[model samples]
Target: MIFKMAWKNIWRNKVRTLIILISIVLGIWAGTFILAYAFGLIEQRVNDAIGYEVSHLQIHQPDYLLDNDPQFVIKKSTDLLNTIKKDERVKAASQRTLVHAMLATASNNAGAKTMGIEPQGENTVTQIASCIVDGEYLEDSDKNKILIGKKLAEKLKLKIRSKIVLTFQDTDKNIVSAAFRVKGVFSTYNAGLEQSTIYALKKDLDRLLNLKQEAHEIAILLQGADLVTDFTQEQKSKFAALSIRTWSEIVPELALMTNSLDQYLVIFLLIILLALSFGIINVMLMAVLERVREIGMLMAIGMSKLRLFFMVVLETCLVFCLAAPLGLLLAFGVITYLQNTGLDLSSAYGESYGALGFRTIIYPQLQAVYYLRIMLMVAVTAILASIYPAYTALRLEPVEAIRKI
Candidate 1:
């Protein structure tokens, strides 16, 4: 009976009721869309970080990561790699002989981290072959061939087939210089990576370093990101002597960013709800004031103050009930369309996003839980917003309210 009365009462003043409903609908729709976009952006960053930069997990000599010394190579890396490959959790693994070195050409020079990689293994693990914009990925048969980033190529004023000198310390701590022709030039969203890293065949690099069949690091990609912690734990038990790290441990900032964004989304939604609350409060209060005589008559006829207060609260809830589903549907439609078409900010924000290693196109995504959460929040907001107006109705003196116009 109270719900039916509340529903009829709200429509008695159609203009005011509709104004509040519109506010609720727009607020929910905007808040949901914004949150979805933010989630998509962060998700994209995590994917790119895994796909291009960190892979899922890494194994290295205990001190190799401390200074990246060429001599701190993983022992019997081939056997270890084969063992890792046989693990069902692992999608792919690649061994790398990394050295900090100076890369130079006739016209220019720059310090770079040169990575020695097996072509086939690297293709499986990092997918570097797909990023090649010029020339070809390093091939096992291509002796002394190197893959440089397009940024580095520009800095060195070199192109494909251009010869470059790689000078680094060999295993004996002796400075060794080797000549490599730039067989490929690749480009990635990360400017720092593009300028500071290059790839070469592991055999060629091992021969130069005089560390046969050893590697400085083993990069592993898992079938899914959720498997990272479990796989890391298992690998730790297997390779107790070597240091194993997951992508999150290696890049704590990415983990922190993802967590922080979740908190920000909650805060953002609260702000939207806060704004919508005021409109509800205003409309409900006006409804109570305009119906003073009717409320007085009901109280005079023996209706309790508690019942009056509840009727007002029920009215407020009905407003939200009418609007919430429509708002959610509109938000869902927009999100689904954008997920397929994508929102392109590339032209306007490409350079900034590229520098930070983020893609310019974003596809918004929202989980089912988010919809449920938003609906609960809106319901809570309606209840809270009704309190003050309901109190005003409860305070109305029956004789005084009945005498008023």
Candidate 2:
């Protein structure tokens, strides 16, 4: 009967109830959006760091991973690649041989790292096809076709179909010369990769390095992030001679970015929760003060103080039960809209960090567990914040409160 009366009493002051409800709604919105946006930014960083630089996993000669030497090449046959492809967990795999060299012209020259990759295979391993900003990606038919970075092209005065000469030292400690026609020029958001790297058909590197049947590394693309660790471990156990590295391991900086983002989000959420708790406590206290005389009368009329306390607490639960769903609904609407039309942070982050190594587009994602936790915390905090006000109301004296009112 006290619970029923407390709930009915809450609606008597519609304005105050609305104020408290709106506060909760606004708090939920703020917390949800901030957490989602931060996670989105970190996710973009991870994808670009992984896709533009390292594929999900890279299989390298143990010596090459430990000691940076051109001689450390994967001498295995195509059978190994075939075996990996047959694994259901593997989406795509490609071979690459990376070398550092000077690409030059008569009036312009620049030092750049070159990657040799099979065009089709690379497309499978990386989003290579989508990254073609100008002209076209590498074509196997063109024996000497090259894809140069936009920044490198500018520095070396290169254009599509323009001839560029590359000079590099082979594994045998011999200088090799190769001329390639720039088939495409790509602009990446990462300035470092754009200024220092180039790509050519795998056959070109094989011919240049005089290694007809060897590759330096194998890159694998996985379907999703969850399976990367397990797959990397499985591959390492199977291929002991090869060193396997996941994207997170290959680029520890990205891991740091993710961790920092998560930490910031945790702190941000805590602050918002604290603000909400204060709002709930204030509202409950005001309501309790307003009803002190009625509470004291009920306690004097044979109603136990404990029952009066539970009544006030029940009133808070009632308010929360009514407001929480509305807040969650509002949050869901806003998040869904923003997720479809992403908030652009490109203007601040710049086009590329250093070179053609990272992409700029970001997509927002929220896990089911994130929503569950927020909902649970909001409900629990509301219930807990009412306790002090409930205790205060129960302690009031019947004669004093009634006479004062």
Candidate 3:
């Protein structure tokens, strides 16, 4: 009876109810929007940084993972590449030979790592072609041409078609010297890649190192990023001699940075939610104040204080039970629209994410747990926020409440 009376009383002051509902809506919307966008941007940066440099997965000789020495070569890389390519999970695969040494040349010199790549195959799995700003990406047709970092090119005072000499220890522990023409200079938002790496044709490095068909690593692009773990496990059993590694395993610093950012954002959102809970408390208090006479009448008519308190608390719950789902629906609608249209933060933000190794465009995604959590938080807040109001109604003297307006 008390519950039915309280439910009817909630709609008596329609304006006040609307005001509180609006506040709840706006608060949840802002929190949802900010958290979703921030997470999306972080994900974009991590993937871009990894894809731009590391692809998704790599296969190397068992010892090469321990120490990436030029001498640690995969003897039958072609056979392994063929076997990996046969897997339906594999999107694209490329073979690479690497030499880690300082680059010395007339135009510029620095400690640099050289990566030998199959140009066409790399394009399928990497953003290398997009990174090229000056000249063009190295083609298989260009035997002696190399693509270099813009910073490296600037340090060397080199231009397109300019000649640069590379010195590194070959597979046989001999210092091999080779001359390469600069086919292009690539610029990345990634400072590390822009400063210390150079790319050359696999054939060129194969000849320079006097290698017949050996490679240092095989880079694989998976269809989906999350599949890296499952694919790695599958590959481990399929290829016995090689070690499989994901981008996160190879580059832990990026993972650490993104993970910290995610945790910070989650904490910040929780604070906002707590603030919203206080707003719910204020509204419930006001509802109890206006209903003192009604509460007193219920008690006079033989409704127990304990039952009245429970009813008032249930009233608070009904508001949240109705509003929370609506809030979630509204949040989803807003996020989905923004995701499809893409929040045009690029113009205002201006590609500042290059340092973080992410693209300017951010695509929002909804995780099931996030929405589930929001629902739980709102429900708990509504129930707990009514405690003070419920207590006030219980303490009211029936005669005094009836005498007052």
Candidate 4:
């Protein structure tokens, strides 16, 4: 009986009730979609970082990156790389030698982290082969051939077959300058990498440095990302001489964003819900105020205060029940459709986003558990919003309310 009364009471002021319901619905839908968009952006960035920039794990000499010294080459690197590649968990592995060098053209010079690589191994791990926008990929058969990034080519005013010089310090602290012809120009989503990095054949570079079969770094890609932590730990014990770090260690900022994403999104949703709750509370209060005389009549007819409070609380719950499910369903449908179609910011913001190492085409997504969590939050908000109005009804004096209005 009380449920029927509560249901009827909420609809008594249909226009006002609708205003609050619609407000809650829009708030929830907008909030959820925003979360999905943010999630998609981060997820894409992480995948690209792992796939294109850094692999699942990287092995480096203990002090090699501190100053990019070619002298700090990994001991027996070829054996280490060959052995590690045989692991069933390892999808691919590659060795690279690094040098802090200057890339120079006749009219320009810029600082560069020049990488010495084996073409086929590099293609497997970093997929640099696929990023070539001009010319062809590096060829193992060719000596003194180079791959330069697009931005670097633009900065240096370079093109295919352009002759450039790489100057750096060798292991003996002696200055070494070598000339190479640009074989290919590639572009990466990371603009910073484009301007600061270049690649040459290890066979050619190692001869210049007078090192045989030595590498400064070994990049390993795992069959599954989830194996990173365990593989890193296992390798650490196996090769305590080398520094084995996961992607998170190499890119702390990206890892931090991924780890804290959920907490931040939940807080953001709470702020939106809080704003919607205020409007809901005001509408609920108005409903109670206008029904003062009706409430008094019910109390005078021996309706207990507890029942009155419960009835008002039920009205608030019913209002939420009417709106939140529809909003959640609508949001879920939109998210599902967009996850495939994606929101392409390529037209307006592709360059800007790619410069920051992010993909411009974002596919919004949310874990299924988050939807349940949002539903619980809405229910809690509804109950909390009902308290003041239910308490006001309880405080009403039956005789005064009946006589006054």
Candidate 5:
């Protein structure tokens, strides 16, 4: 009975009711889309870090973990590689021989973290082939070919087929130098990584280091994201001597930022709702003030003060109910579309975003669970916004309200 009365009262002033409704709808729609964009940027940064800098899991000797000494090799790495590949949960596995080397071009010299990798295995695990912008990816048949980053190539004044010399400490702590020709140039969103990393064939590095079937790191990619913790724990038991760590352990800052983003989401939503609540409160107060005589007539006819309060509150709730779904649905459709065909900001901002550690192309996505939370928050906001107007209705005397023309 109260709901039916409230519904009829709402339509009595169609223009006013619609004005509030549209405000709520637009507020929620804009808020949700902005949140989705924020999440997309954070997710993209984490994905890029995992895809390019580190795999899902890594194994290294205890000494190597302490200092990354070239002498501390994972013995019988070929056997470990076979064992890792046999795990059903592993999507791809690759061993890499890492060295901190001085790369000298005819024009300049720079420090680089050179990763010597198996061409096929590394391509499967890291998907570096997709980033190749110039020349071609490394080949097993090419003994002395190297892959360089675009930024690094620019700094070193290097190009495809350019010869460069690399000097680094080998297994015996002896300095060794090698000359290799650039096979490709690649680009990544990480400016720091782009300027400091290079790649070559694992067999070539192993020969230069005077070691056979030994590597500094074994990186693994899992079939599913949920499998990372369990797989890492399981591998710890098998290779107790070696230090096995997940991507989180390798890059703690990324995990920290990811965890912090949820708190940020809540904070931003609260601010948006708080701003909307003020407008809602003013509209509801006016609605109550405008119908004082009718409310007094109801009170005189033995309608309880509590029931009058509830009726006014229900009116606000109805407005929210009419608007919330429309807003959520509109935001969801737009966000979903953007997720498939990304929002490219590159043309407007150029690649300068990479210098700030962000990708220009963003694919906005929000988990389904967040939509439910947004609905819950909106309901709470509606209830809170109705408070002041409901109180105003309770304060009016029946005789005084009836006298008001």
Candidate 6:
């Protein structure tokens, strides 16, 4: 009976009810859209980091990461690679010979970290082949073929088939220089990485460094992100001598950003709800004030104070219940459409996003749980917003309220 009365009473003033409903709907819809965008940006950053910067996991000799010395090679790397390949949780694994070398063109020289990778294995573990913007990826048949980033190529004033010399210390502590022709130019979202990394065939680097089949690093991609911890733990037990690190440990800043995203989103939603609550409070109070005489008559006719307060609260809840679902549905449809046709901010803000290693095209995403939480938050805010108006109704003197103009 109270719910039916509250519903009918809220609609008695159609203009006021519509005004409040519109506010609630817009508030929920805007909040949801903003959160979805945030989720998309975070997702993109993590994907790019995993796909290009670091694979899910990496295995390295104890001192190899500390100093890029050619002597600190993983023992029995081929056997370890085979063992890793047989694991069902692993999507791909690649053995790499790493060296810090100076890349020299005829007129310019830049320091870069050279990665010697198996052509096929590297492709499986990283998206280097797909990120090739110009020319072609490395192949087994191509000897001394090198891949450089577009940014680096521009800095060095070099292009495809340009001969560049790499100078580094070999396994025996002797400085050796090898000439490599640029076979591919790749570009990733990360500007810093683009200017300081190079790639070559693992066989060529192993021979140049006199390491035979030994490798300094083994990078692995897991079938899914959820498998990272379990896979890393299992690999740690098997390869205790080698240092195994997940992408989180490799990039702590990215891990921190991902971890704090949920909390930040909660705060963002609360701020929106807080603002909307004030508007609700004003509208509900006006409803109460306008009906003062009617409320007094009901009280005088034996309607209890508690019932009047509860009726007002119920009205507030009904307003939210009516508006929340419509808002959520609209948000869902818009998000779904944007997911397929990404929101392109590139034309307006390409350089800014690129500087932070983010692509300007974003596909907004939110889990089902987020919508549920938003609905709950709206319900709570409605109840809280009704408190002052409900109290004002309870405080009314029936004799005085009935006589007021």
Off by over 4 Å in 3: 1-16, 101-107, 150-157, 188-191, 225-227, 253-268, 321-326, 344-352, 397-405
Output the better candidate (1/2) by TM-score: 1
Candidate 6 C-alpha lDDT tens digits along 1-405: 888999998999999899989988998998998889889988988998898878898999988778767899998899889989998888999999999999999999999999998999999988989989989999988899999999999999989999999999999999999999999999987777788899999888888889976999999999999999998998899879899999999988989989998899889989988998998889889999999999999899999999999999998888988998988888898899999998999899887888788888999999999999999998898899889989999999899889987
Best prediction by TM-score: 4
lDDT of 3 by residue, 84-130 (tens): 88988889999998877566667457778888999988888788998
CA deviation > 4 Å runs, candidate 6:
none
- lDDT of candidate 1 over 165-216, digit per residue (tens): 9999998899999999999999986777788999988898899899877999
Q: What is the per-residue lDDT of model 4 for residues 179-276, given as tens digits with 9 covering 90 to 100?
A: 99999999987787788889899888888888887988899999999999899999999999888999999999999999999899999999998898
Reference-based lDDT, each prediction: 0.91, 0.80, 0.80, 0.91, 0.90, 0.91
* Clashes by residue pair, model 5: none
lDDT for model 3, please.
0.80
Candidate 5 per-residue lDDT over residues 1-405, each given as its tens digit: 999998988888899888888888888998898889989988998777778878898999989988878989999998999999998999999999999999999889999999999999998889678899999999899988899999999999999999999999998999999999999999887777788899999998898888788999999998987899999999999899999999888989888888898888888888888888898899889989999999889899999999999999999888888888999999999999999998899887646778766889899999999899999999999999988999999998999999998
Error of 2 at 37 (Å): 2.6
TM-score per candidate: 0.94, 0.87, 0.84, 0.96, 0.95, 0.95
lDDT of 2: 0.80
lDDT (Cα, 0-100) at 222 in candidate 5 = 88
Candidate 1 structure lDDT = 0.91
How far residue 280's Cα lies from its native spot in candidate 4, in Å, is 0.7
Error of 2 at 136 (Å): 1.3
Any residue pairs clashing in model 3, and if so which?
A: 107-156, 108-156
Q: Candidate 1: where are CA atoms >4 Å away? A: none
- lDDT value, residue 13 of candidate 1: 86
TM-score of predicted model 6?
Answer: 0.95
